[model samples]
Target: MSKLSISQAAKLKGVSTQTLRRWEAEGKLIPERTAGGHRRYDLAQLMGTKSELSFTVGYARVSSHDQKEDLLRQVEVIELFCASNGWQVEIIQDIGSGLNYSKKGLKRLINLITDHRVERLVLTHKDRLLRFGSELIFSLCEIFGTEVVIINRTEDSFFEEDLAEDVLEIITVFSARLYGSRSHKNKQLLQELKNVARQL
Candidate 1:
């Protein structure tokens, strides 16, 4: 029944100290406080509650249909990584711009997290989740006690290309919304944008 400080407990749990603090606030993982108001976690108690989570979720995304191979590669990588860790994973793949929030797979993943059915979320990279607003999702995960694992924290080789695509998507969506999707102005604007994107 060894007791550990918040940092030590967070390290042992593979989560951040901030996450531990949030969990404490949410009454999910309360710790005993010393006279000095330092939180102390019981190792035995932590270990005993380890099996409560449902399963790990592996999420893979590509910005377009042309990148389906890349999506598959991400899935394979996630599966192998989770297997090495003995994590039972369910792979969810998405084909859409990272800036698109309405993707079916992304919505499903959000639902699972919000429902507290996911123990962990495995990704090849953080941006694979979204070109923007990924942090909001991560914050949601923390609130729901879902651990996020990004296997590759390094800069992505295709980052520039993906960012360009997401930028194009944003422009296209906004152009259509402003000019009317079926209007000639919208079509011309989209074509011009695509041409410029291709030239770069």
Candidate 2:
């Protein structure tokens, strides 16, 4: 069996290396690895499938200044999931709030999608890629005629699961820290936010 390196496979398919990595993480596609712990793609994996286009690409992201914190752990989880499932991925690291559309890594991902001329996407979760409401982002994906698969979505309730309540609690803690260190109305807002968060 002829094995192709990740880069060679990407170059052959004319997609970005990053996109392949994300697909791998989303449990959409997997690549065989070389003896040196390097990733290799099978040419047949990119062609001759029923879809007549066996090529696949993946994209992953996390938004936090402390990327090495929980974000890094999340990446590791996604990676293991992809590796076990025989998928390829593209990893993008950004150190900013997800609310920022102009994030450097995100922009690169967008460009790679357009530049590569593919129509498939993979994400860990909808919330990971989008923290805020993203009507515009959805529209862009539609315009690109892309089919996206969220490998690990919080809303996949049919799977008998949901975002861990602890995750939301951590978010509440961050919000509290941001506003609690204040006076007057700030304290009131903190209390209100806490109440709302508790309700969540």
User: Residues 33-129, candidate 2, lDDT per residue (tens digit)?
Assistant: 7678899777777653122233344544544343446557656766676565555545666655555577787787677556534445656667555
lDDT of each: 0.82, 0.57
* TM agreement with the true structure for every prediction: 0.69, 0.47
Clash totals in order: 0, 18
Clashing pairs in 1: none
Q: How well does candidate 2 score on lDDT at residue 108?
A: 70
**Model 2: how far is 50 from its true place, Å?**
14
Runs with alpha carbons beyond 4 Å of true place in candidate 2: 1-60, 117-119, 155-200
